[model samples]
Target: MRVKKQKRNRRTVKFFSACFGFREPFKVICDGTFIHHLLAHRLLPADDALAKLLGARVTLFSSRCITAELKSLGQSHSESLEASLQLIPASCDHEKRVNAAACIESIIAEGNGKHFFVATQDIELRRRLREVPSVPVIYGLKNSLLIEQPSTAQREFVKCSEEKRLHASVSEIQILRKEVNETDQGRDSFDPDQSSRTRTLKRSLDSTEKSKFKRKRAKGPNPLSCKKKKSKEVSIPSPNKEGSVPAKKRKRTRKKKDSGLEQGSGS
Candidate 1:
């Protein structure tokens, strides 16, 4: 049983601490059995596992199924179990174990390990939760409670995975930006008229080449060319040629007459 003075003293300290902005408390999802065990064994004050590790006390949470189980316990255990239920700061009203697991999984998934813990004695549940990286478990050891620190490798793995994801996202953004810039450049330099003119010029060149090839093929040696005879050129004389004077004789006679006239004049 808690003394009234101690309770009042705690309340006073809490009230003052709240006003002064005290340290944040760790968040712990717990089962009813662990709570009853701590209270019954008078070990709650001495355990201090979370405080030692986190430098702060914890705010407890549980599922409604745990609360119901505590309520249904025999009368012999009712008072202590009831007191334990009251000690929990919040209870998730989901009835199934799966629901509780799901809720705790989400909290762990946040990757804020220093602020969250899971307290339970269920062996199967502990095994399953341990599979999640960086999840700490608090369970009973001997007459006191202890916190099982998360595996170092698990923490490192989670850190590396997060870094890889961030790198991949950043690289993806860079690639997308590069693509967008290239697209913008292409658009800025594009000329529709130039492209169309280029296509027309190419078509004309191709047509000219095709026509040249067809002409060469047609001009190739024909089969009849080998059998054809060559034609000879023949000159024909004119009928009026008998009365025409020769060009050389006319020049000689004109030169002789000029010479005779010069002699007669001289004489």
Candidate 2:
């Protein structure tokens, strides 16, 4: 089924200034492309969530890529992103580094001595904002806001904290599938997590075994492991085995549906 398009109207700094910062009525520049993106796809800075975070007088711009992504997200989503975009198209063609620097400079210039803030999830923008030796600005997302000079250390700390929290939440959410000893309140607290679990090297393994072992509990892609995906072994029924079906085909019925239940009866 085709989804219906939803449209949102243009917003300004006057609307959300007080929503994110310590004070109200601040001059803020939002990344419309970012908004388009958050709304068009998945990730943080959720569309409706971010909208409620901004004010009416807000100015918005987007990276050429983000703008393209939004406009191409199709008419409905594009309209949603355009509501707060201020529709200022940013130049990202050629000289990527230069254009990015100029974009931030232009935003700062526009602020012109009043309290101005730049809101984005872009790392490079965050870096440039931190490196510049001038006015104070704030960085934010939905519901939470912070002001800083875009220091890597600060960013790293924030990133680590978020990841740690997500890991804990994920573990707590799945805790019931494994442990029976955990109390309901203990489960609710979300203390120790699988992410927090680290292993000590008890003994050195032989190279052949280490290289051949296919099961790994680590998260994400990692190099240096001398391992290749092993082709699935075909399990055959033993001649002496009784009552076991062949490893391949077993029960057969048509009109298969999902894990919930079969809608139609079968012979």
User: CA lDDT, every prediction?
Assistant: 0.61, 0.47
Among the numbered candidates, top TM-score falls to 1
Q: Provide backbone clash counts, one per model.
A: 0, 15
User: Model 1, range 85-117, lDDT digits (tens) per residue?
Assistant: 565545343445444455555555645343456
What C-alpha RMSD separates each model from the true structure?
26.7, 32.6
lDDT of 2 by residue, 2-25 (tens): 111111111223222322232343
Q: What overall lDDT, based on C-alpha atoms, would model 2 receive against the true structure?
A: 0.47
Candidate of highest lDDT: 1
TM-score of each: 0.47, 0.29
Candidate 1 lDDT (Cα, whole model)?
A: 0.61
